[model samples]
Target chain A: MTGTEPTADETPTTRSIPAVAVVDAQTPGNVGTIARAMKNFGFEELLLVDPPELDPDGEAYGFAGHAREDVLPNAQEISFDELVSSYHTIGCTAVTNEGDHNHVRFPFSTPRDLAQRLPTVDADTAIVFGREGVGLTNDELARIDEICSIPASADYPVLNLGQAATITLYELREMTLSPAGTQLPDLERVRASQPLLERLYDQWDELLVEINHPEEKREKTARMIRRVFGRADPTTREVNTFLGVLRRATERPDQEE
Target chain B: MTGTEPTADETPTTRSIPAVAVVDAQTPGNVGTIARAMKNFGFEELLLVDPPELDPDGEAYGFAGHAREDVLPNAQEISFDELVSSYHTIGCTAVTNEGDHNHVRFPFSTPRDLAQRLPTVDADTAIVFGREGVGLTNDELARIDEICSIPASADYPVLNLGQAATITLYELREMTLSPAGTQLPDLERVRASQPLLERLYDQWDELLVEINHPEEKREKTARMIRRVFGRADPTTREVNTFLGVLRRATERPDQEE
Candidate 1:
């Protein structure tokens, strides 16, 4: 989305990604920051739901920087009912602790999990961010289909409105962009299967016994090895190579040096 | 990191995670919001690098809410060179374009990428954020080891300081908290090797041909299938099962039901 100031020749286009809607936000800084975040994450639609009057030329634009025309100018003012009807509503809440299990906002999806689920959602969706001091009213949250929250330190879970929007949008953008290009290979590489790992472990155990590993420390040593290799999740090929090395190392003295 | 205000009896502990530092941030609101972001991401250390005098009783504490003690009271003031020597400095910059490639901040790592690398970095690390208007100066950036930027729309590259911190710290926290306790098993599950994927593709192509998929759309259809399955990255078991199903589906009427 270009942040160019709108001219008579230009027309707005609707975006396919989830639209961002802030409900009753109090500050221009937050509004501007939200706009900037939407642009940063390649999202264009913004709905100002019952927000205080925002001046495009003032703090809103000042904070929005280049997103002033693309995101801020195009932001629509919509009613709560309109928001509910136009898209599958996702309410955002900070109340995600076990204490809130009975609360309406319980079982909240973290932003990353929500992002992965968003693209598969068949309809237009809106992620509703609540106000600064107090978040969404209980009544407002009741109508939401999904509750998404950023996991944070429970001691002070409150996040600035702008920060919350940025984090959520960042995750969604990360998920969306991931499939298109070089997904993190390190994170996605195939790992050795359980049977292969166990076999490798058995080979290593025999080697340890033949080497006369300190009797008292052998179990601790084996457990450490299991823990370390288990965490690594080596690939099948790697496991095979390691097993080959172990076989040679453990072979009797009759084997050639 | 708990958000509780620190008391005289409670001692602060040094954290292994990167410390957040702000240089010449103009607004108290920005400082408060940054503190809130830090707390939200479980980061404890905050450094105010030559900031204007801030009133803890005013906007900073008011906006920080529960993070007042854990973040605000513990914030330290230090000089530029002091920052450089104290930690492996990561300079924050908005200028990540190719034009700036020759510039000091070129070749910046995205926040997510940086987060992945942070855990292995052996030293105290500080992610230094710049002023609200201009980010870190080129001279200041020169002394830093890594430049980390959030990927965003080129139209409005500027992000509110607080939002930037929130997004960067959120990514780091996500990566840090990940791989502990129930990580996404579906996402982390080892995938089938390339040879298996190719075999499955060959089987699917034959099935598509058998189903009388139109000639003109066959390549496109096959490509779409490849993309879909490629993205899913089915496991060895899943691929074997699907291939078995495809073999049955493509068999002549002589095959058993």
Candidate 2:
């Protein structure tokens, strides 16, 4: 199983804590800052879905400082669908009072709590955050396994988006502390590389073009691929899964034999 | 003993992660990002060396959305000197390759490996990152134990400062995963809420106005308060610390008797 998937723990320690996934997070500054954020709490493995190689220099580094490279280097930019299919994502956003569950510790509790619960989960979890201002859509939130809320002062309850992500991570780490001596899976190797993901995606695109799907159908096909893999958050273990899917879809079932 | 110290497991679950101390990280956005960085990885204590209160809302939080608050809310802003005394602080920067022992980790290295061999270390090892632009001056780096490097591709060896911080944290987290069940300390009763922080800062200015401290010193004094408590990263245990400090500093020792 890849780092994204939550395998039943051989021992509590053996369980992989869910990771922090930044989906469609477009800001370079935020990217650097988030890297620094991940590092601060020992949460490595930054997955950047659907972003360009960022400008190495900007005002954003003021916070990332020494961490710029760490965050930058580990960051993997992929398609939105890749993010959706690749991860068992737990997306966080500010909820209004109408939400019934004000206090479920899963997402809002603490980093430590989240970590503890990870082993219990059946699939992988990647925490997705939306771009600033336009928080995750209902569609996006619906895709998540569970929704979490941080209890904030009722008045200005919404946390700055990145801050919310950071808080969830913070709480997750706090919750993760326990059952030591559990062998952590090696530092997860992210998707092969941008070039690799780009090539693979391109290969699929070529096939899609050939299928001669209707103009309106093209977008739907792309979106479908995006959704299935977005939740997958692929790791070395899943190379075969994609290879198989790509082989079948591209070659056509008739050609597989 | 305080924040960023690598205290031997009082909590059975917390693996020893390297501590990162900000030696005068002046940018408000940087501060917030750093705090968020820590939270993302499940770290609580962020030690700031002498920073301003209500550090102007730089892009740090706006980008962070909810996370920007961590720089203010969860940060333990302290003096560089106090942090050094409190933990194993490596006071250096990778400003230029010649100046720093920059062992760039472009490929990757665990932050814990660096943590184990940290310079002039205490159990609580702190890697002190400096203020903007001019990193820790040679004078500051000298006090450090040993310089650690985030191995980078030889080409772009120097990471943007904040990115450097992000990378460092990422590496460290790779090494140390706290044993599960390590709980975070609860928030101090009198957290410097946005309003609280804003009001206190302004009131302190007025008080300084009353005392007629130098106009220049007014900002400096306000900054000092922010630095000290912010570094403290106060929890429920810290309410009295704020009140007590305020009582003594504002009212005058002479008046207390």
Candidate 3:
């Protein structure tokens, strides 16, 4: 399933894909935490919008761990307007917050939903995480195109800055890397058609009755056979083989020995 | 959708729920970051299995944010054996790692898969995350019932300690809080049956032809109409309304006024 960890040779240049921007972020530790998450999910660019004097030497790097050199030093400090013009900005907000009534934050997509939508777009995208205190203000939210939020417990729907960033990036990375519509391997057999599957099930149902399976259980046993086959998603050839076995079992009802 | 941020009266006591255990966790900030994530996801208990001296006054609390009061103080330090005895331990690992041949890590479930399985188990559970560097050794992994790993880019599948914890806890909490099989609201309209939808599409297809919607574009236009309506998943009543509107429009032929 992991198709071998994409070597340096396989991993394409990741810059200009989707940048992560933190607007008026309060804590340096959170920024450091965000940087670590960015690296985990294969995102490189970090944008700090209108700002704070970050402890580049201290908290930011300290918390960043291995990602310090890759994400922290190169993080760009830009005004909110600068970020808006360069990329399609997606504002992040909590759905249960007071801002839910606010038009700008009303239609919030879950991170997974946003991730699914992002791969179809070829444009450079920026997922902006709001401040630590109250999140993005009305003015800041207005500048973005769409809003994305992680679905959390309604009681404490709001996630910490780092946690939100990590979850969002994780979903984005997983989705972007392996799209939901990804095709299966060519070697894997195609599933049998509906009519053939129905025939197979019919044979199994008859066999169950011939075996004197409990009258009450005949229907359920037949249904379970359908479910197991459905989950297997067997090829036409496999289905035919199974049907043959059932046909033999039905024909030789006295061959229980 | 977020039902008024469940009131304190509605909030369930979360003391003995599924806990998070950090085994020999090296960084103080990662622990703090993890605590904040735990609180974000409504998970309360924390077990530190032979962890380092955490910065109680400094980094741990500072990074914990709002979760400091709830999760940090009550965190208990216990031996690995005690953790194994107390709960159904789930080891977290990376898929791209070299432990595929190992029994515990080979058939690792994704957090989503693990979450679905957890609700069926009546026993207390503990999801154990390994150290920041090399994840749980083979010896430690063998002690757990099952392994859970986040699907990440093969190029860099290893995530930072806190980010890994945050993502895992996020999925677990989201699933535990809102199981996928939960019924939708009663107000939600039931979708139209397949035959009804097919008939509606056939009518629309004929209407498209009558309107002379660019002879070459007729098929595409009809298909697009089907796609649009298909996505809306209209109720039987709504489908009838749309069919009636289409029927009238087709019959009028020349209703320019």
Candidate 4:
């Protein structure tokens, strides 16, 4: 029964990411968890349909992480009919039909597919989730414009509500949030340059000769070393360390003799 | 302290999916949630390091869904050193370093990348997750051979332990499970043949003739109908329905006049 009126300035038309709608959620904690996931993935809007009482001191608040202040408090409440008419609705269903015989669930897009497709769509979209025990009713799913399913094991395709929402948001993060919003370190590493690699390989060859390595096997061994380093994609620091180790080994033969 | 000896016949060598290891999980419910996600994605083995007491009547059992009888109960207890020594470990972390200076957290693979890379690796691998609140310590991350990170919004990059495990498992399902294991319907729907589409287009032209549709507009309207049906990829049933409706519309104009 808890609802709030969206401010005139912050309407659905102004937002780019899809609003998340939970219909008849039995547990307040799940609502909070979904809201938290929304914040985690840069989704701003939340809509609830027949949600449980979300008291300030309840489990919902406890599980909301950082979303309690914004995403949870500003959640708008709307009727199912109003949701269908106002936005392009995509129903989230864990259990999908196996064939086109039941078109309500078949021909569904996975979250990855939706991530790619939703960008070209011009309408403001809402991704709807159903109750915890039984997902969206067939009638409700039929009314939605499209269906989205997460690919899972046939034996147990059903994921708990929170997990489903979090995973879906994670897949859609690229479109919903800018690349600058990721905390993951930049993937571009400064691998050792070709000259440095060649010097290292020469040192390795010299060490093999110093150790009385067979002349016939020297070429093969050198090729193997190149392949190994190529696959490892060693950084400059790693290559320098290897060079140092090889220098010590190559010099040791003279010292020992 | 609870541990079981893995039977001789069913060892790590025979299994294809990575063993999911939870290092010092504080909550029994989180442990159960991880186990349930493992089952959902066809991962079999569960390894625990200093886990909480998983009593039969505890929250662990309640939240395990179908994993209680198998994955949770059979979880093996091992020390962190034992984990590093026995398996090729890939540590899972939420917060990663921003540059190559911190090698422990940098140069990590996303779950999608791991899904492609792990299959080629010949060794048995274990994907390790750390504590809920503090995640894996830097020392622990350094010990693991590789790292896998789930991309998230920088504002709130951290995900609850259960959500991280669930999403990782979902991404790795392709390598872990068989194609026949999916419940999603076969995507190869029998689209209406070319002849059927031509007939439907011809019927639309006849309807335009019956209505005395403006000659200039008629060609454009016919092309639009063809384009719409082409994009729709309508099945034979749907195309027949369209033909039937168009035929009725064309016949009605003659009857009315």
TM-score of the A chain in candidate 4: the value is 0.87
Q: Give the per-residue lDDT digits (tens) of candidate 3, residues A164-237.
A: 89899888885345532212121223567999999999889888888899999888788889898996666576
**How do all the candidates rank in terms of lDDT, highest first?**
4, 1, 3, 2
- Listed models, DockQ each: 0.12, 0.02, 0.13, 0.48
Which is the better candidate, 2 or 3, if ranked by lDDT?
3
| Selected candidate, larger TM-score, 1 vs 3 | 3
lDDT of 2 by residue, B176-234 (tens): 43433122213312344555555555656666776778997777788987787575333
List chain B TM-scores, each candidate: 0.63, 0.51, 0.63, 0.86
> For residues B1-257, what per-residue lDDT tens digits would candidate 4 score against the true structure?
11234566655444367899999999998999899999889898999999999999998997788889899999999999999999999999987766566688867788998898887666678999998889999989999998888888888888888888988888889877777777676563447799999999999999999989999999889998889888767767668888999999989756784
True contacts kept of each: 0.27, 0.00, 0.24, 0.56
Candidate 2: misplaced stretches above 4 Å? A1-14, A59-71, A96-113, A174-257, B1-25, B31-257
Lowest summed lDDT over 10 consecutive residues: which window, candidate 3 chain B?
Answer: B180-189
lDDT of 3 by residue, B39-59 (tens): 777788899988777766877
Alpha carbon lDDT of residue B129, candidate 3?
Answer: 94
Candidate no. 2 TM-score? 0.37
If you assessed candidate 3 against the hidden native complex, which CAPRI class would it receive?
incorrect
Better of 1 and 4 by DockQ: 4
Once fitted onto the true fold, the runs of candidate 4 whose alpha carbons sit more than 4 angstroms away are A1-15, A252-257, B1-15, B188-190, B208-214, B252-257
Locate the minimum summed-lDDT window of 10 residues in model 2 chain A. A179-188
Local accuracy of candidate 1 as per-residue lDDT tens digits, A1-257: 33444567876443357889999999887899888888877788899988777876678888886788788999999999999888888888776434222336654677877877777654588999999878888889988876787766645566778888888887888433443322222223346789999999988898898899888998888898899888665667668888998877888656677
- Runs in model 3 deviating more than 4 A are A1-16, A51-56, A95-101, A175-257, B1-16, B53-56, B95-100, B175-257
